[model samples]
Structure formats: structure tokens, C-alpha cells
Target chain A: MPRRTCGNRAMIWALRLGLMAGVVLLWEWWAPGGLLPTPGQVWHAGIGLAAEGRLWRAVGDSLSIYVAGMASAALVGIPLGLAMGSFRLFGRVVDVFVFALAATPRVAFIPLIIVLLGLGFQAKTFIVFLGAVMPVVLNTYAGVLAADRDLIEMARSTGAGRGRIWRHVVLPGALPFLATGLRLGATIGLINTVVAELYTAVRGLGGLLAIYGNTFRMAEYFVIVAMLATIGVIVTEAMRAVEAHLSRWREER
Target chain B: MTHIRIEGLGHAFGAVTALDGLDLTVRRGEFLVLLGPSGCGKTTLLRMIAGLLEPKAGRVLVDGHRPEPGHDTAMVFQNYRLIPWKTARQNVEFARPGTDVSGYLEMVGLSRFADAFPGALSGGMRQRVALARALAAEAPILLMDEPFASLDAQTRELMQGELRRLIATRPSTVVFVTHGVDEALALADRIVLMSPRPGRIAEEVRPGPGMREYLWQRLREMVLNDPGSDFYGREG
Candidate 1:
């Protein structure tokens, strides 16, 4: 069984690589004399940028902003969601505001945010926070609201206090939701980070993309885009690992 | 010797009355079972006694005072309702901090599975954990709401026997609710048969000493004829 599973996995990888090669070959053939650069040229451009240390520096800058924004979102969103879910009156009162913020297009607010916070780390962080916070808040709220009432009643019958019930039952029950929120937040946060740099900042992967595209450095621009995609993939994979570790006790249906 | 007293206890959900005119007194160290068919409000009465619900009218007193959940009462639910994330040991510990959880697990024959989570255990094992947690709570008053109802027949019999033995070792004021006539006969010192809808005591039977068979026949008649089947047609 193990051998067959391994063979299947290898087959999947081979198919994926073959598809990528086919796409790259097609693009290469199509881009010979056009404005678009070939895959080989993109790979070499990536190597050249890496050698110059610009790629690494840009990565570092973008990562810092991304981390900051995500951290702030979690800090703010989780508690808000928990409180909103646990207290009915609180939830009702806050529902309108949360809905308004979530429904508003994040991009439309960028100019306003820039006018208020300026083109600095704070502005970039705010943009990412806006992009990330909605999913985190909504998922956490739903998780808390969706907690098994029977379990809470059982806990109470066992002499557990309100705090103990929340800790033992509500929090652990909400973990799957929390993991989902983090994964989504990571993806959107990365997008916001790139947008922030592209629109306002002088450094980061988004800034590099903007500069390269404007100068018709097609190969380098593709590399930056690939790097952004890689970040999203890495974040999602990491979140999935955390989710699996935390929720190992669940019996899959 | 009365441990629990219910005086004209009544409750309703909107227009549908769940329980009404309940009056009873449970003696200390007695195993009292509330026996009724489905929707007869046996569970509702048990919940009220456990302070999980407030009576729309009347009152319940335990030890001459209003009962409180997690203070003097511990409940075992039909669904087990163990925390899905915590291990059996952790669940028991959460019931009453600073208690010997392993000892409680051992009592329920779950010491081997103490580290297992609820999702990993079979239905019977999860119920055992719930029992252990209830025992660990060290409550003088025990309320059970059809605790073994969801177990398979074989496991249900095993659990019934196990519960009987456990109670024999440590006597408490136990109010067990169940729809199973046999279950009541096996575990109850006194069984209170309830009428359907707006539940009230239809008949109270004491299957003393070697009267299990006779008591079962009598209680089954009451369960089927009195108010339940008459209202719901022989489905009782």
C-alpha cells in the first residue's frame, strides 16, 4: 500500500512538472520577438537579482510589513470576534459596523488611508490589516457562535466557571476556524503588501514588480510575480501544518 | 431524609408546556429514575433539578436550598458531551481541578484510554469518560439524563451493570432520567413513570429487592397506557 501510494504521488509530481514545461515552452515560442520574455530569460534574471542581493532585501522588507499587519489583525480581530459571538447584545451592536467594514472594497480605501497615515510603514501595515482582518473576524465569530451548546451545558453542570468553559470548550472548538482565518488572511495580506509597495513604497517585491514592468523588464517582473505566488503558497502550507497539528483529535467524517 | 424537593414545578417553551405540576421529594442516598416515553419531559424535569433550566412556575430545592450547577450537582448526559479536544484524563480533571483523574478513569474502566480524546473513543467509552468526569466532580447530588441511551444494546447493558455497581459503592442522591423501562428497573430504587406532554407522575413503582420482573410489567403498562400512548397512539 505504501509503495503504491508513493508511486501515485510521484506520478502526480511528474504530471505537474510536465504541464509547467509545456507552458514554459509555449510561452518561449510565443515570446521570441515580442515584448514578453522567455522562461529561460526569466530564470536568469531571477539569478542575477539574487546575486545582486536586491531580491533578498526586497523579500525582507515585504516580509516585515506582512508579519506586522497579520499580527495586528489577529490581535484585534480575534478578541472582537470572540466577544461578539459570546455576547448576543454585543454581537448585535457590533454587527452593523463589522458588516460595513467588510463590505467596503479595501482598494477604495487605500487613497483615504494614505491621506490619513501617509506613505510609511504604518500606511502599508494599515492596508494589509484591512485586507486581512475581515476573514479573521468573521471566521472567529462564526466558530464561537457555532460551539456546541450541549458541551457548554455539560461543563457548567461539572462546576466549570465561565472562564473555564470558554478555555476548555469554546477556544478549542474554534481552532479549525482560526486556522482557516489565518490561511485566508495570509493570502489577502500578501496581496495587500504587494499593492501597498506598488502604489506607494520604494522597496519590496511589489515595488520591484512596478519598476520592472514600467521599464519592460518582463523576465524580472515575472520572477517577482512568481515570488509573490511562492509566499502565498508557503504561508498556506504552514497554516495547514498548524491546523493539522492542533486538530489531530478530530475524527474525520 | 429528603435530599431534593420539587414543588409545583412548571416550565414552558412559548405556548408549548414541557412540564407542569411536578411535585416530588427524593430521599437521601436513593436512586430515583424518571421513566417516560419520548417528549414526556423527563429530561426537562432533570434539567430543572440540575439548575440547567429555570421553572416557569414553582421551585426546586436541594438540601433545603435552590440547587446550582457545578456546585452541589453533577450531570451525565445521554450524548456523553465530552469536550472533543480534550483527552479523557483532561476532561475528568476539568470537572474538578486537583482531583485524582486516573482513579476516576480506573473506576470507569477507562484508565487505559485516559489519554484518548472523545473523537477517538467509541460511544460507550465516551459515556464512561462522562461518568468519570461526573464522579470526579464529587457532587453529592447526581443528575443523569438518559446517559446510556445512545450506546449499542450490548454496551448499554454493560454500562447499566457498571453504573449499578459504581452507585452501590458510593451512595448519592441520584435522579436518573430514561425512557427505557428495563434500564429503570435495573438502576432505580424507585421509578416515577411520567405522562406525556405537560408531564406529571403517572405512577410511582418501587421494585424492592427481587421484584424486577413484576415491576417491569407494571411500569411498562403505565408507560404505554397512561397519557403517553393514549395521546400519541401506541407508539409509546
Candidate 2:
């Protein structure tokens, strides 16, 4: 049975790699004048950017802004979410405002943010923060609310203090939900990083995209887009790994 | 002496009364079982004693003071509410932090599976972890609401015997609630039967040595055909 599973896994990998290669080959043959650049040319552009050290700088700038926004969101969102989830009175008071903020189109705030913070890292970070914080807050709140009451009661029965109950019961129970929120926030933060840079700044990957597009550097543009996509994939995969590690106890393995 | 005293205890959810005007006294280190049919307030009574539910009209006193949840009392629930994120050892250790959990896990025959999480354990095994956790806390009053009700017959019987032995070794004021007559007979020094909705005590019996057969028949009669029982009241 193990041998068969191993074989099946290998076959699945083979198919996935073959499909990706096939797409790149098809794109290469389609047209040289087309909007999309070929995978090989995109790869060549990535190497050229790397040689000039522009690729590293752009990547660094984007990541720093993204991380700053995401970290601040986590700092604000997690505790607020826990408070709102665990206490009915607090939840009632805060829910309306949180929902209103979450419902507004975050992209629409870019102009306002630029006006307030100017075309600096602060504006980009604020835009990303607005885009990302809502999901983390909402999901964390829902997770805390949805935690099994029986478990909470059990913890209470064990002479656990309020803090202990939150640590041992509420936090662990909400981990999967928190992971989902973080993954979503990371993705949205990426998008906002690009959007904020597009609207205001001339640094980061988004800025690079603008420069390449205006200069008709299609290969370079595609490379930057590819890099953004790769970052998104890597961040999501990392979040998933954390989720699995934390939730291993809950899953029937 | 009395470890827990319920005086004119009453509880209602909105318009539906679950328990009303009930009073009971549990002696220190005695295995007092609350035996009744469904909706007879057995659970409500247990919850009140555990300080998890507030009585609408009455009060529960633990050691002559109002009950304090997680301090004077520990409870094992029917659902075996173990923390899914913690292993068997951690669940037990949670009850009494900074204490070695192996002793409790060993007592429950779960020492070997101490590292296993609730999700990985069988229903009976999870219940054992819950039991071990409750035991480790060393609460003066132990309240259980049909803690083994979800187990299969063999496992239920096994758990019943295990619980009896565990309590015997470290006797506490135990108030166990169950619908299973055999279970009560097997575990209780005294049994209190309750009436249906708006539940009140109907009968109390002490099971003496070699009286299992007779007591079983008598309890069956009380459960199924009593004139003033909830059985007739619901039917009427």
C-alpha cells in the first residue's frame, strides 16, 4: 500500500511539472509581438535585473512595506479580535465600526493615504495595513466565537484562571482560523503594496512594473509580475505549513 | 459532614424550568449519584453544584460557602470535553499546573498514551483523560454529569469499575449524575431519583450489599410505572 501511494505521488508530480512546461512552451510559440512575454525571455530578464541589483532592491522595498503593514495589522487585530470575541458587550460596541471599515473598498483609500502620509513608505504601509487588517480581525473574532463551549467549560472546571483559559483553550482553538486570516492578509497586503506603489511612489516592484511598462520592457514587466506571484505563493505556502504544525494535534493522523 | 448543600435550588431557561425547588445534601467523601430519566434535571443539578449555572431562586453551598467554579469543585462532563490541542498528559497537567501528570495518567491506565491528543484517542480513552484531569485537580467536591454516558456498554462498565476504584483510593465528595440504573448501582453509595421537568427529588435509596437484583427491579418500576413519576406526567 505504501509503495502504491509513493508511485501515485510521483505520477502526480510528473503531471504537474509537465503541465507547467507545456504552458510555457505554448506561450513561447504563440507570438513575439503579443502582450505576454515567453517564460525563457522572462527568466532572462530576471537574470539581467539581478545583475543590476535592481531586482534585490525592489524586492526588499516591497517586502519591508508588506511586513510592516502585516505586523501592525497583527498587533492591532489579534487582541481586538480576541476581546471582541470573548466579551459580548465589547463585541457589540466594536462590531459595527469594524464591519464598516472592512466593507469599504480599501483601494479607494490610496489617494487619501497619499494625501495624508505623502508618497513615502508610510503611505504604502498604511494602504497595505488597511487591505490586510480586516480579514485577520474578522477571522480571529469568528474563531474565538466559534470555539467549543464544552472545552471552555472544561477548562473552567480545571481551576484555570481567565488568562489560562484564553491561553490553553481559546488561543489554540482559534489557531486554524488565525492561520487562514494571516494567509489572506498576506495576499491582500501584496496587492495593496503594488496598488499603493502604482498610485504614489517610484520604488518597490510596483514602481518597477510602471517603469518597465512605460519603457515597453514587456519581458522585465512579466518578470516583476512573476516575482510578485512567486512571493504570494511562498507566503501562502509558509502560512499553510504553520497551520499544519499547530493543528497536528487536532487532526486524526 | 456535608460538603455540598443545595437549598431550594431552582433554574429556568426563559419560560422552561429545568429544575425547581430542589434541595439535596452531599456528605464529604461519599459517592452520591443522581439517578433519573431524561429531562429530570440531573444535569442541571450537577451544573448548579459545580457553580457553572446560577440557580434562579436558590443557592449551592460548597463547604458552607457559595460555590466557586474551578476552585472548590471539579467536574467531568458527559461529552468528555478534553482540549483537542493538548495531549493526554497536557490535559491532565492543565488541571494542576506545575505538577507531574504521569501519576494521574497512570491511574487512568493512560500513561503509555500520555503524548496522544484527544483527536487521536478513542471515545473511552478521551473520557479517561477527562477523568484523569478531574482527579488530578484534587477538588474537594467532584461533580460529574453522566461522564460515561457516551461509551459503548463494555467500555461504560469498565469505566464504572475504574471510577469506583479511583474514588475509593482518593475519596472526595462526588455527585455523579446518570440515567443508567446499573451505572448508579455500581458506583453510588446513595442514589437520588428526580422527577421530570421543574425537577424535584422523588426518591432516594441506599444500595446495600447483595441487593443489586432487587434494587434494579425496584428502580425499573420507579422509572417506568410510578404513579407520581414524570413518566405518567408526560404521558398525561
Candidate 3:
């Protein structure tokens, strides 16, 4: 059975690789001229950016901003969500405002944010934070509200005080939802990082995209887009790994 | 000596009364079963005794003071409410911290699966963990609400035997609730039959010859007369 599963895994990998190769070959053949750059040209452009050390610098800059924003979002959002969920009066009072803000487009605030914080790291990070925090707060709140009543009752029956019950039963019960929130927050944060770079200081890969697009350097533009896509996949995969690790007990079910 | 006293115990959910003007006394180291049809408020009585619920009109006292959970009682719920994230050992330890739980786990015969999560265990095994947890607390009272009601017939019988053996070795004031006549006969030293809804004590019997038939007949009469009784649905 183990050998059969291994063979199945190998087959799946082969199919995925074949599909990717086919897509690249098709793109190379179909879009050789005009605005579109061939795969080979994009590859060469990526190598050029790497040789100049611009690729790593842009990646580092973007990642640092993304990390800072997401970290702040989690720090503020989780506790706030917990507080809202735990305290009924507080939740009822604040939820209306929270939902209203979440419903509004975060991009609309970018202009005001740039005006206030200026086109700098702080402004860019704040934009990412705005994009990331709502999902974290909303998901965490829902998670706490949906926590198993029977489990909470059991804890109470064991004479667990309110704080102890929250720590042991409520927190652990909400972990799967918390992990989901973090994953969503990370994705939104990355998107906002690019938006921030473009709208604010025009730095990182977003800056490269603007520069290359304005000059009609299609190969370099494709390189920047590919870099962004790669970063997105890596970040999402990392979040999934963290989620799996956090809920190992739920894995059997 | 009396271990627990319930005086004029009454409760209602909105207009639907569960228990009303009920009074009972439980002797120390006694195995008493509350047997009735579904919706009979047996669980309500058990919860009040566990200190998980407060009686709206009356009071439940354990040894002259109001019952307080953990210090006064440990409970085994029908759902086997073990924390899914904690291992069997950790779940048992949760009942009373700062004490070795190996003995309790062994008592439930789950020493081999101490590291296993409740999710990974069978229904019977999960209940064993719950039993171990309740036992580890070493509380004066053990309140159980149909702890084996969800198990298959064979497993339920096995658990009944296990429970009897365990309680025999370590006696406590036990108040168990169940609708199964066989279950009550197997476990209880004295069984208290409850009336359907607005529950009150109907009869009390000690298990012996012809008692099974007598209880079944009484239950059938209650089910026939009480339109709200879910007994027929449950038995069928």
C-alpha cells in the first residue's frame, strides 16, 4: 500500500510538471511579438535583474514591509477579536462598526493614508495592515462564537475559572479558525504591499513593473510579474504549513 | 449518613417546566439511578447536582453546603466530553492537576492509549477516558448522565460492568441518570423512577427478581399516558 501511494504521488508530480511545461511552451510559441514576451526573454531578463542584485533588493524590501504589516495585523486583530467574542456587550457594540469598515474598499483609504503618513515604509506597511486586519478579526470572532458549548460546559463543570476556560478551551478551539485568518491575512497583505509600493513610493517589484512597462520592456515586465507570482505561491504554501502544524490533532478527523 | 439533599428542587425553560417541587436524599457511598422516559428532567436533576445548572426555585446541598463543581462533584456526560486536542493522559490530568494520572488511566484500562487523542479513539474508549478523568478528581460525588447511552449494546454492557467494578473498589456517592431499564438494574443499588416532564419521583425499587418486568410495565404505562414521552421512539 505504501509503495502504491508513492507511485501515485510520483504520477501526480509528473502530470503537474508536464502541464506547466506545456503552458510555457505554448506561451513561448503564441506570444513572440507585440506586448507579450517569450519565456526565454523573460528568463534572460530575470537573470539580468539577478546579476545587477536588483531582484534580491526588491524582494527583501517587499518582504520586510509585508512581514511588518502582517505581524502588526495579527498582534492587534487576534486580541481584539478575542475580546469582542468573549465580552457580549463589547461585541454587540463594536461589531456594527467593524462590519461597516470591512465592507468599505480598503483601496479608497490609500490616498488619505499617503497624505497622512507620506510615501514611506510606514505608509506602505499601514496600507498592508489595513488590508490584512479585517479578515483576521472577523474570522477569529466567528471562530470564538462557534466554539463547542459542550466543551466549555465540561471545563466549567471541572471548576475551571473564566480565565482558565478561555485559555485552555476557547483558545485551542479557535485555533483552526485563527490559522485560516492568518492565511487570508497574509495573502491580502501581500497584495496590499504591491498596491502600497505602486501608490506610495514606487519601490520594490511594483516599481520595477512601472519602470519596465513605461519603457515597453515587455521581458522585464514579465520577469517582475513572475517574481510576484512566485512570492505569492511561497507565502501561501508557508501559511498552509503553519496551519497544518497548529491543528495536528484535527488531522485524524 | 446523607451525602446529598435536594429540597423542593424546581426549574423551567421558559414555560416548559423540567423538574418541579422535587425532593430526595442520597446516602453516602450509595449507587442511585434516576430512570425515566426522555424529556423527564433526569439530566436536569443531574446537572443541578453537578453544579452546572442552578435550580430556579429550590436548592441542592452536598453535605450541608451548596454543591460546587470540582470540589463537590465530578461528572461523566453522555457525550463523553473529553477535550479533543488533549491526549488521554492530559484529559485525565485536567480533572485534578499536580497529581499522577497513571493510576486513573490504568483503572479505565487505557494505559496503552494514554498518548492518543479523543478523536482517534472509539466511542467506548473515549468514555473510558472520561471515566478516568472523573475518577482522578477524587471528588465525594460522581454524577453521570447516561454515560453509556450512545454506545452500541455490547459496548454499553461492557461499560456497565466496568463501571460497577470501578465503583465497587472506590465507593462514592453516585447519582446516575438513564432511560434503560437493564442499565439501571445492572448499576444501581436503588432506582428512582421519574414521571415524564415536570418530573417528580414516581416510584423507587431495589433491583431483584421480577423487578425488570415491573419497571418495564411502569415505563410502558408512562409512555402510553404521556404524549410528550420519547420512549417509544427511543426503544424502537
Candidate 4:
């Protein structure tokens, strides 16, 4: 069993390296076939965009909407989750509504969001927030509910006040779940941002892909697809790093 | 003033009566162990004395007053209740967060693992951290619920030594709970054994000098076929 587990780990590493190599090889092949943009052409485009400062501008615009939408979701969702989790009454009152939100396909609301928010940045932000809120709320509530009863009693027995008990015992216990929710929420938020840009004809990688699709420029569309994939990977990796750091600290005590 | 007293103590969960009409007394600076089988209300009694549970019928008094929430009380739990996020020093520091942290760490011989978290440490090491936390609490009365029960025999012996050393340094009136007769004999000044269900004080045994070697023979006769003495209902 141990040897097989070791072999499995080795296979995973090999597969990851092979996947990276295969993507580069296929990109080179398909670029010539007029379905993929060459590395050279993308680099040239990157440099030109940098010179005009449009690359940074594009990044800033997307991030501004992303951060705003995420913040709004967190402000509303986390507090609601905490309230729902901390009190039996609140949990009973809102559990059905929260479940409804979780089960709803957020993309289904894009058309309704457009009608309300119009084809502007507000519409994009609205969609992003819609995708981001549920995970945070659900995870926070579950984490609070699942915290160990003995730990809470231990804190209380030690002359700790109610506030201190909540801070020391409850908050730390719920952290792992909250971290999980935030990471997943961020990914969903990013997808919604790009989708909103695509549907509304705004200036984003998604919009750029849409323009390319209209002109039969499959290589450019493929380039935007690559960028979106990279963004997803980067965001997920960042969240994973944060989670690892917290776990390392948590495990040591 | 009596340091600990239980009067007409009664508690029940649904139809099951865990503790009933139990009256007890613990003097200051005495090591007393409550020994009983599983589901015998040993832990429930300890928790009530520690002010974790409210009595359904009567009252528990610690230091001449009713056991109150957040009093001068410290319990070294069987589960080691060490915060998972904290380092060894951090866990001890949690007991006295505003004081000098290094002193408690040094006292527990955990100065090296001040930054090491609970998951990285062995069970014995984690229990040591928990002991340090209880000591740092500076409570006059300490309550321990089978704190050494989970450890291996060797580790349990060393922990017993560590606990004895701490008891010598700082004399705190403690109520210790366990199922092991040897453990109750080794560390306790007074060993109070309870009946099976609706636990009551069945017998109180005091083993004098050469206690460990002597009680081994006496307790053998009282026990059922040298049954394995596992404090928390697990096999030793």
C-alpha cells in the first residue's frame, strides 16, 4: 500500500510536468495552423499594451470591480452567516432562503441583473457579488455550528468573559471553513466578472474574446481563453497559499 | 472555610440519572481522586464542581461559595482542550495572556516548543502543555478529568511524575477523576471510589507509604479478575 501511494504521488508530479509541456507544444503547433496565437505574437501584443499602459489599465479595471463585488458579498454574507449560526432563531428563519440561494444557478440571474443594473460596471459587479456570497455564508454557519463544545466550556471555566470565549474558542475553530468558503467564492466571483464582460460587451479579456469570435479570429479567442485559465490558476494558488500558512500555524500548537 | 463541598447534588439527562443525592467534601491542599466505571457520573461530578454544569436539584460550593461560571477554577480535561491554532507557549500564554509567557513555558519544560503547534507534538507533550496551561491559570483549585488516561504506560508514568512535581511546587486543592486504582493510589492523598450507576461514594481508601507496591496486592482482591484499568473506558 505504501509503495503504491508513493507511485501515485510520483505519477501526479509527472502528469503535471507533462501537461505543461504538452500545452506549450500544442500552442506552437496550433498557432501555425491558425487556431492558436504564437508566443512571439502574444509577447509582442503584451509589450505594445504595456507601452500604451493599457495592460495595467485593463488589470486595474477588472480588479476594481472584482474587489468591490467581493467586499460587498463578504460584508453582507459573513455577518448574515454569523447571525444565522450564532442564534437558533436566526438559523431557523433564514436557512431556507440561504439554501434557495445556494441551489440557484447564479448565471441564471444575469439577464435579470442586466435589467436592474443596466449594461454598465454595476451590472458586472452585481453578477460577481451574486456568485460570491453563498459559500461564505454557508461555510461560516457550518463552522460555528461544528465548533467543539468542550473547548467552549474550557474557555468559560477559565474565567473568560462571553466576548473572550467567542474570540478565543469560536472564531479560531471556524477559521478553516471560512477560508474554504472565501477561496471558492473568489473563483466564482472571477468567473462572473468575465462572463458579465462577455455578455455586456465591455473592455475585458472576455470582451476581447467576444470581439475575436465575431471576426473569425480563432487564435485571439484562444489567447483570451489562455489568459482566463491563467487567472483562474493564479487566484486558486493564492488562496491555497493562505490556507497552507494558516494550517501550518494551527498544527504547531 | 471548606475549599469544596457538594450538598444534595442531583443531575439527570432525560430519564437517566447520572448523579443523585451525592454529597461530598474536599479539604484544601489535598489530592483526591474520584474513581468509578464509565457512565458512573465521575466526569459529571467533576464538571459540576468546576462550574461547567448547573445542578438540577442542589448546589456545589467551591471555597465556601456556590460554584460560579468563570470563577478561580482550572480543569485539565481528558481531551487536552489545547487550542489547535496555538503553539505550546501560546496555549499556556492563553491562561495568563497579559503576563510573562516564558516563565510558564519554562516551568512545563516546553520552552523549546514555544512555537510548535499541538498537532506536531505527541500526546504526552500535548498533555504537558495542558498541565502548564492549568498551572498558569493560577487557580487555587484544580480539577482534572482523566488527564493522563489517553497516554501510553511509559508516558503516563512520566506525566504522573511531572504532575507530582507540580503538586509539590504549588499546593492547589485538586479533584482528580480516573478509573485506574493504581493511578488513584499513586498520586492521590485520598481515593474515593463510587458505585456503578447513580454513582455514590462507595469506598474511600488511603494507601500510606510504599503505597504503589502495597495497593497492588490489596486492590487485586477488590477488582474483578485483574481487569484492565482504563480510565476513560478504553482498554489499558
On DockQ, the stronger of 2 and 4 is: 2
Per-prediction DockQ comes to 0.59, 0.64, 0.68, 0.51
- Any idea how many clashes model 3 has? 0
The best-first sequence of candidates by lDDT reads 3, 1, 2, 4
Docking class of 4: medium
Compose the digit string of candidate 1's lDDT tens values, residues A1-253.
2487579878987997899899988988888676788888989999999999999999999999999999999999889888988897999899899989999989999899889999989999999999999999989998899899999998888767889889888888988998898788888999999989876766799899889989988989999998998889889889987987788788522
Give iRMSD, candidate 3. Answer: 1.4
Look at candidate 4 and tell me the lDDT of residue B89: 83
**Candidate 4 Cα misplacement greater than 4 A, ranges:** A1-18, A27-60, A250-253, B208-236
Error of 3 at B23 (Å): 0.7
lDDT tens string, model 2, A1-253? 2487579878986998899889888888984666777788898999999999999999999999999999998998888888899897999899999999999998777778888899999998998999889999999999999888888888877767889988888888888898888889989999999998888878899999999999988999999998998899899889987987777776674
* Clashes found in each candidate (C-alpha, N, C closer than 3 A): 1, 0, 0, 6
lDDT of 4 by residue, B60-169 (tens): 98877877643557889998988888778878877787887787778778889888889989898889899888888888888999998889988898888888898889
lDDT of 1 by residue, B1-236 (tens): 99999999898989878888989999999999988667778888988899889899999999999998878799999888888888999989988887678889999999899988888888889999999999888888889998987877788999989988888888788999887767787788898988766788878888576556655565567556755443212211
Model 3 TM-score (2 dp): 0.96
| Two-way lDDT contest, 3 vs 4, winner | 3
Once model 2 is optimally superposed onto the true structure by TM-score, how far is the C-alpha of residue A184 displaced, in angstroms?
Answer: 0.5
Clashing residue pairs found in predicted model 2: none
Per-residue lDDT over B82-128 for candidate 2, one digit per residue giving the tens place of the 0 to 100 score: 88888899989998999998999999999899998889899999999
The candidate, 1 or 3, that scores higher on DockQ is 3
Q: Of 1 and 4, which scores higher on TM-score?
A: 1
Q: Enumerate residue pairs that collide in model 1.
A: A159-B70
